[model samples]
Target: MEKYTGKSVLKGIAIGRIYWYRKQEYRVEKVETADSEAEKKRFADALETAKEQLSGLYEETLARVGEDHAMIFDIHKMLLEDGDYLDTVNGVLEEGFNAEYAVETAQNQFAELFASMEDEYMRARAADIRDVSKRVIRILAGIPEDGILADGPVIVAADDLTPSETVKMDKNKILAFVTAKGSSNSHTAILARSMNLPALVSTGISDWEAMDGKIGVVDGFGGEFLVEPEQELLDEMIHRKNQWVADLKALEQLKGKDNVTGDGRRIDVFANIGKVEDADGALEADAGGIGLFRSEFLYLGRDSFPTEEEQFISYKSVLEKMGDKKVVIRTLDIGADKKVDYFHLDEEDNPALGYRAIRICLDRPEIFMTQLRAIFRASAYGRVAIMFPMVVSVSEVKRIKEIVGQVKQDLSAEGHPMGEVELGIMVETPAAALISGDLAKEVDFFSIGTNDLTQYTLAVDRQNQKLEATCDTHHPAILELIRMTVENAHKEGIWAGICGELAADTDLTETFLSMGVDELSVSASSVLKVRKAVRDL
Candidate 1:
């Protein structure tokens, strides 16, 4: 029995046979072709065939995943039809290179270009190009496009799952996912989380092919994959899996129940969402509202900044889905860890403590106002609230409100009807928490971002694995800061809430309730569980 450890992004247990994934590989040889026109014709034929395949894949992916994710296949089809790709291949063909060699050269050149990009998402697109080119090459080489074929359910083992490849996969056949290379923030991990599939990423498993057809146990909770496990180990895992399923089934009963305490004290339980698709999960878990809609995801995978209409559409979708429920949208928190290329952010020695969040938005008012306009326009659809991140002083809040007022004026002049929107600021820094009383006077409510509050107060980088023990959100000092912030907000007649991971912490449920916290926003998956805890209180 061999066991391998990895980072587990999603928690679950899967016992299934291993199905090693390998892309169809073909070798190209440099050959002198007398008929250059014939070589060009062959290349064009292969490209057309690849385009057809991608069109079908796009439709399939749209049905499987949502349009946002399925757009990746559409992107691939565009790349194939690109004039650059065609001209490069045809140029190589005119240089006396065969069809296969020309295609290989063009693919390698474009793949290198994308791989060299600083943007991680753009860098990952190199794989998409290679995947598509491989299809064309296989057709040109007369090799069948052999995909991952398994007889029954299997745990897919791969180096990495591209956006194109992941969406094309059969969800029913894929019991779980184990990858040699991927991160919790990768597209594959995001897709896995959306599907509620067990996934173990960065497993560094190079011998996955050898484990084909062999029964393996994926212990997502333990972050390990057991290959050819002992009978006793398998039995224990099966029992644990059964228990987890039972717990999930039990949590289902908590859905649609009002998050009220035994003493009839009511508190709103909301979900922190990154994208519009998360609205479904929030509703499934019966969340009262969406507390934190991380607006950065809209800016992340794209080549340029999203337009006002684009942002408006996304915000409108989430607001419309939630209906009367509140949706607190955080304006572009782009800086520190979440960097964008077009923003051209300068290299800072310490980004967390340096310029980020409100700092960036404040400096770039054009960008900030565009986002504000979108949020205001979307407000017309449903209840929408705007929240600023990494705020420290009253001046920033005042300035933000000033800009929001200007945006409202601009929209109104354009004959756009505005909705009744509330403005809030995130108390993530110690400075913000200390002056919560003064800050509370300027906003509708307070949403304590405990993750940043803990990091900044403790002088610890939350992203650092080595200081994991030091970054304690449960520290008395941290709790006291939250207490002060919540107290200050209530004093000003503005409700306070916790939106960080600590909001869902059951151990602090009574503490938040005692502190007069009006709401707790956590992940969609934790809404029911947290609501259950709140009710039991």
Candidate 2:
């Protein structure tokens, strides 16, 4: 038996035969073209072809994984159209190089530039450029695009996978993914998490081809991959896999069940969504409501800020789909890691602690008011609530209330029909949690963003992989803060809920119940699992 340890992207167990993922390799020879103009035209034709392919992929991915994940293809299309990228390719072609060679040159130059970036997110975009370049080059070389093919379900092993490659494969045939090189921040990793697939990255498995068709066990919870395991180990893994499957089936049974503890304490279970289409998933998962509708998604992957009508249409669609279910839409929380070029935010040494979320909204009331007016306008369609992110003080909440009040009045004066909307703030910072007693009085409820709360309370950079060990979500300090926030919220006659990654942790479900947490909002897929945990407690 051979054992390899790596970082786990999602927690699950899979026992299957190994399938080595290999893409066709194209060697672009540096051939001087007699007709430079013709070569440039060929490159342009290939770029157009690549854009069309990406457009089709976008529609397919959108139907499969919804908008947030599908936006990756849109980004790829944008990169193809980017002026700098086009200029580099054209400059190479100007030197009388073949279209294929020019594309390879541009790919190398752009990939190197992105790989050298300081920000990890930008660095990951290097793979995206490489993917796009390869697609265009394949067209120039007249090679058919390749995708992973397996006879049956198998654990996919690869050096690394690009987002396009991951999405192109038949997900039903993929039992798990084991990559020798990848980051948790990679788009492929995010897609794996979204698909609820077991994935291991940075495994350093160079001889993956040799293990093709070999029985493999992926222990995502333990961050271990077993190859050609002994009978004893194989049996143990089989047992664990069976147990995992059983647990999932049991969770399915809890779908329509109330999120009530054994002692008869009932709590609301909701789902956090990024796009309007995600409301369907939440409802399918039996989520009582939408806890955190990340409104910033509307602002991303676009040229400029979303107009009032655009935001209103998006919000109204989600609200109408959700009907009377309370949909808590968070105001624009774009900053820090989530940056937009049009925002023109300055570079900061520590962006997590810099201008972000409510800070940006407060600093630019024009942007904040625009979103508020849209949310209020959508409120007429169905139940709606507005939540502010990164609020740290009662004064900030008060200012937000003033803006919200003015927005409501403006809409009323315009004779727009509106429904009652609840106002709340995300208690993410230590200052917000510690001052929850006062801050709670200013809002209708408190939604603790444990992801930021834990990071802020421990002074740990959550995005830094090196600090993963120190960024403990279940730390006593974090629990105490959650407890304090919930207590203060109840004291002020306002309910408190958790709407972070930690909220989905079944292990912490009982602890949150003990803290009197009124609600838990997790991913749509985790709703039933969390509900099962609550009921079991």
Candidate 3:
């Protein structure tokens, strides 16, 4: 028996045969061609074919994953149409090169350009270029795309999966996925979470060829994979798998039940969502409300800022879906790790500590007001609360309230009806937690964002995997901050909640209940488990 361990992002057990998957490689030879015009024409035909295929794939992906993920394919299409990319290909063909050779050369040049960037996000775009290039070259060389043609369920093992390939995978035939390389934030991991597929990454597997057709068990919960396991181990794994499924069934029954502790303490179990589409999942999970509706997604991957009406429609849809349930919509938290080209933000050595979130919104009130006006308009439909991100001072809170007042006044002058909306501040910085008493008086409630707070308090970059062990949210310091924030909120006749990953941690559920936390907002999948934890406690 052989055992391997890796990082597990999705928790489940998958037992199946191992299937080694690899993308077909198109060998590019620098063959001289006498007919340059003919080669150019061939390249153009391939481009046309590639465009059509990409458009169809984009639509399919949109139907499967949603617009945010489908945007990657659209970006791929744009890259194919880039002038520089075309010029490079045409230039190579003009130099008496074959169409395949010209396309490959141009793709490598652009890929290297992106791969050399210091920013990790930009560097990852290199894979997109390579994925698109492979498609076009395959068409030029008459090669079929790689995919699973297995007869039965299997665990797909690969070096890595591109966004396109990941989205297009046949879930029915694939029991789970294992990769030799990838991070938790990679497209593969994102898709696995969305699809609820058991997956393992960075397994350091160099001998995948010998493992094909071998039966294996993937323990996603433990981040382990066992190949040709002993009978005793296999029996234990099968028993665990059955228990997991039974637990899921039990969790489904817990929905619609009160989130009450054993001591009769009641708490609100909310959901943290990104897009309007997430409202359905939140509702399915029986969330008490949406504690953090990340409004930044509306501002991302677009050419310009979203108009007031556009934002209103999006917010209203979610609000209307959860009538009478509070929906906390955070204002645009741009800059830092999240950025838009039109914002024209300057590069900073330490963006996390630099201008971001409330800082940017304050400097750009016009943009801030646009979002506030939309939230107010949407409030007319149902319960809507506006929350500000990365706030560290009472002065910033006062200024935000003043701007909101101005927006309401302007909307009233224009004869537009608006509803009453509650204002809240996210306690993410140590300064915010320390001054929670002062800040609590300015808002209706406080939502502790432990993700950022842990980073700021520990002086550890959460993005740095090496320091992940050091950035402990369970540290006594973080718990004290939470305890203090809740105390301050109650003292000021307000409520305190946690809307970070910590809120979903089952082990911490009892601690939060004991701390008198008013609400716990977590991911949709985690809602039932958290509720069960509260009930058990």
Score candidate 2 by lDDT: 0.86
Give lDDT tens digits, candidate 1, residues 205-291: 998768988998888899999999999989999999999889888999987788899999889999888778778988888889999
TM-score for each model: 0.76, 0.71, 0.72
* Poorest stretch of ten by lDDT in candidate 3: 185-194
Model 3 bad stretches (over 4 Å) = 1-3, 15-36, 47-217, 226-239, 301-310, 339-342
RMSD to the hidden true structure, all candidates: 6.7, 8.1, 7.8
Which candidate number has the best TM-score? Answer: 1
The whole-model lDDT of each prediction reads 0.86, 0.86, 0.86
Q: Which model is ahead, 1 or 2, in terms of TM-score?
A: 1
Q: Model 1 reaches what TM-score against the true structure?
A: 0.76
Candidate 3 clash figure, as a count: 0
Compared with the true structure, the alpha-carbon lDDT of candidate 3 equals 0.86
Q: Per-residue CA lDDT of candidate 3, range 1-537, in tens?
A: 999998886899989899989776457889999999999899999999999999998999999999998998899999999999999999999999999989889888998898777775677677788889989999999887768878898999999886546545676788888998875545566556544568898788878888889999999999998999999999999999999888788899998899998779999999988778778888998899999898876887543567777788999999999999999998887775654766888898999898889999999999999989888888889988888999999999999989999999998898887777888999999999999999988999999999889989999887564675787779999999999999999999998999987898899988898888999998777889889998998
Sort by lDDT, best first: 3, 2, 1
Order of candidates by TM-score, top first?
A: 1, 3, 2
